[model samples]
Target: MKQLVRFFIIGMLVSGVLLYLISSLNQSQGYTGGNTLTIFNWGDYIDEELITQFEAETGIKIVYETFDSNEAMMTKIEQGGTSYDIAVPSEYMIDKMRQEDLLIPLDHDKLPNLKNIDERFLDLPFDPDNIYSVPYFWGTVGITYNAELLPDKTFTSWNDLWDPDLKNEIILIDGAREIIGMGLNSLGYSLNDTNKAHLQEAFDKLGTLTPNIKAIVGDENKLLMQNNEAAVAVLWSGDAADIMWENEAIDYVIPEEGSNLWFDNIVIPKTAKNIEAAHAFINFMLDAKVAAQNTEYVAYSTPNQAALQYMDPEMVADERFYPPPALTEKLEVYQNLGKRNLAYYNDLFLAFKMYGK
Candidate 1:
C-alpha cells in the first residue's frame, strides 16, 4: 500500500510540472517576448483579418484598440497612459498632431508601396511631403435623406436643408467643424475660411438650421436615418453608402455647392516605441491584397490605386460612391486653423448648439 501511495504521489508531481511547462510555453507564444505592436484606430475601421495575417507574417503580435471619434483618440493619447505604435487620424487632426510635433516623420523608404497611392493625395497642405502620414481611406461628407418621406423635395443643394419644408425633419451630425463647414459650403464661403465675417455668416446660417434639426447626434443618427425617423442626415459618404445599401428609400448626395473631401491616414505618434514593427504593419497594410481586403471590410474608398483591381467592379464603377474628376473639383479638404481660430470655431459651434436663432 505504501509503495502504491508513493507511485501515485510521483505521478501527480510529474503531471503538475508538465502542466506548468505547457502554460509557460503558451504564455511565450501568445505574448511575443515583448515584441507585440500596439495599434490604435477607429472602431470597425480595419479588416481584423489583416491584423492576424500581419502577426502570422511578421511573428509580431498586435495589441489593437479602438476609439469612436477623433476627439476620444486624441484625448487618450494626450492623457499618456498608453503608447500606441500606430494611430489613424483624419487629415485635419494630422495637421493638429503635426503642429504639436506629436507625430514622428515616417521613413518613406520603408513604405515603398506608397507609389500605389494616387498622386493627388500626396503633398497636400497637411503633411505636404507625406512625412508623417499614409492614406488609409478617403471620402466626402454629404447628405443622406429619406426621399420617400419628402417626395416633393428635390434636395439638389445644401440650401434645400434650409427650406422651411424640412423643419423638424433633419438630424445633423453632432460635429462642430462638420456642422460649421456645411454652413460655410452652403453660403459660398470656404469651409476652412478663417475670416471673422465668414464664420459669423456660417454661424448665423447654422442658427437658422438649429430649430429645424430634430437632433444633433453621432452614430445614433445612423439608426435614426435607417429607421426613416429623420428625413435627412448629413454624414460621411461611406456611412451613407452603407445605410443606403440597406434601405432603398434613402439616397446620398453631395450638394451641388460642394462639400468636404477627407482622408484618414495611418501615422506613427512621436511616443511610438515599436517603430520598426509599426513600419512593418503599415507596409503590410499597403500590400495590394491587404489594401483591397481592408477597402471591402471598411466599405470606404481606398487611395491605393493598385488595390482597385481587386475590388468589386460594380462598386468601383459606381460614381456615387467614388467621386469622379468633375465631382472631385468641388470637394474641399479641411485644414487646421491656428489654435485661437480653432478655439473660436469650437465656441461658435457650442453657442449655436446652445442658442437657436
Candidate 2:
C-alpha cells in the first residue's frame, strides 16, 4: 500500500515538472497568456537577435512562426484556424491579399519610421497609396552558375537554362509562378502573363527544359549550388548573395533577357489582435541600424535608404545588390494574376510537377 502511494506521488511530481517546463517555455516565447504579438515570416528571414532585442525592449512576448511561400501563408490565414499579427509577403501577394481584404489598412500615423524607407520603393503599383504595407526586403530572381562546373559556358540570358549541354546539370525553382514566370520572361513576355495562350506557351516552354533539369527545388537550391551539385540554378538574389559569399567559385547574373524584381513587405493582418505591438515591431524594423542588421544577416536588399550607410561598401558595389543599369532598366515586377489565369497556371504547374520528369 505504501509503495503504491509513493509511486503515485512520483508520477504527480513528474507531471508537475512537465507542466512547469511547458509554462516556462510559453513565457519565454512571450505567450504569457497575454500581450503576445504573433509574427509569421519567411524561413530564416530575420536576424533572430533583433527578435530578442524587440522582446526585451517592449516586454511584449513574441510568438513567431515561419512560412516558406506567400501562398502557404495566405492559405493558413484564410482557413481561419491560426492568427498572426504580422506577415511578410512579396509584391504580387500584397495586391492579392488586399483584394481579398485579408489585410488592414496600416495606420501610418502610428508608423513615423516609415519615413526612413527609400522613396524609390514607395508609391509602387502594388500598394501605391501605401495604405496596407511597408517595404521590407526587395530583390530580383536570377541565375547562379558554377565557374568550374560550366567551364567556358557563357550565361547572359535565361535561354542558357535550355542549352543542351546543361542536361542533368541544372536546377530550377519548384514554385510554379517563378518557373513559368522565368519561361515567360525568357520569351520576352511579362512574368505575370495572364492570357491563357501566353501561360500555355510558358508551360510548353518550361516543359522543354524539364528533360535537362536535374531537379526543381526551392530552398534546397542553397545547398545544391554550394556543393556544386548543379552547374547552374534559378535562384533569388537574396540567396545568391549569401551563397556567393560562402563559395567564391560561383557567380550570379541578371540575365539580359530580364527577370522578376520583387519586394517583400510587412503588413498587419485582419486577424491581428495586438495592433499596437504589431505597429511597434514594424517601426522598430524601419530603424536604419536595425534594417541594415537584418539585410546583413539575411543578405537581402533593403528598401531602407539610410541602412546603406551601415552596409559593407564592397557588398553594396557587388552586382548582386546593385546590378548594371542595362539589366535594371528591364527588370519586370509581377502583378496579381486573377482567378482564371491563376488556376490555369496552377494546373500547368501541377501537370509539370507530376509528369514532366
Candidate 3:
C-alpha cells in the first residue's frame, strides 16, 4: 500500500509540473486557447519582415494569402471551401461583405491605434463610424502614361484616351469595376450607376475604345505602360510609382472629371481564431514609425495621421502620391449599391468583357 501511494504522489507531481509549464508558455505567447488566425490580403500589402516581427512577438501564426481583385477574394470567402481569419478588401467589397453578413463588427476598444486614423476616413457610408474595418491604405485610380512618348498628346482628361491617333497604343485595366467606372464617370454618371440606360451608354463607349486597346491587364497596367508596350494605361497611384521607379518615362494624372478613390481596410473576421493577437498585430502596424515605413515601401497612402509626420517631406509634397486637395475634390468613393444594382453591374460588365474580347 505504501508503494502504491508513492507512485500516485509522483504521478500527481509530474502532471502538475507539466501543466504549469504549458500554462506559462501559453501566457507568454498570448495563446489564450484558440486556433491560429488566417489572413487574406493583396500581394505586397504588408511588409513581410514586419509580419515576421508580429508573429515572433505574439506567437500567433498568421496564414497569409493574396488575391488581386476584391471580387476574387469575395468569391473565395463565399464559396466556403477554406476558412480565413481576416481579409483586406477595398471600400466597395467591404460594403458587399457587410450586406451579406459575412463580416463581424469590430470592437474599437480593443484597437487603440484606431485613433491614429484620420477622422476624414471614419464613419463613411461603408462601415459607418469605423465599426467594421480599420483603414489600411487609400489611393486614387487614374491615368498613368509615358509622358515623354505623349509629349504632343496633351493627355489631361479621360476623353484623351479616345483620340483616334492613339488607337492601338493604349492599355486598359482588365478589372470590370475600374473600366466600367471610368466610362460611367466620363459620361457624368456615378461609379455605382444602376440605371440601365447609363450602363448601356457606358458599355457602348467602352466597346468603341476596346478595338483600339493594345491589351487588357490589371495591377500591372503601369508596368506595360513603362515598358512602352502601351503608351497609356489606367492604374493605381501605387502601381504608377512602381512603374516610375522602374522606368522614369511614365507620369500619372488624375482625370479632369475625376476618378475613383478607394480605401483598403483591415478587419478581423468572425472566423478569426486569435482575436487579441490580430488586434495586437494591427496596433503594431498602426504605430507611426511602422506605418511610415509601410507607406514608403508600398508606395501607398496611410490613413494614419501620425504616420504623416514621419513620412519624407518630399513624398508628402509629391502631387502623384498626394494629389492636391483640388484634385481630390473631383474624386469620389463608391458606396454600396444594393444587390439589384450589383446584379445589373455584373450583367453589363460581362457583356462588355464578351464584346471587347
- lDDT digits (tens) for residues 1-357 of candidate 1: 999999999999999999999879868767543587889998889988888899888889888899888878887777776779999998988988887778899999998888888888888888898999998999988889888998877777898898888889888887888889998999988788999999999999889887788988988988888888999999999789789878899988888888998999999987688899999889889888899988888888888888899998987887766878887888888887778998999999999889753
User: Candidates' TM-scores?
Assistant: 0.88, 0.85, 0.82
Worst 10 residues of 2 by lDDT: 26-35
TM-score of 2: 0.85
lDDT of 2 by residue, 58-95 (tens): 99888889998899999998887677999998888989
Q: What ordering of candidates by TM-score runs from best to worst?
A: 1, 2, 3
What would you estimate as the lDDT of candidate 3?
0.80
Top-scoring candidate (TM-score): 1
| Per-prediction backbone clash count | 0, 1, 1
Q: What order do you get sorting by lDDT, best first? A: 1, 2, 3
Clashing pairs in 1: none
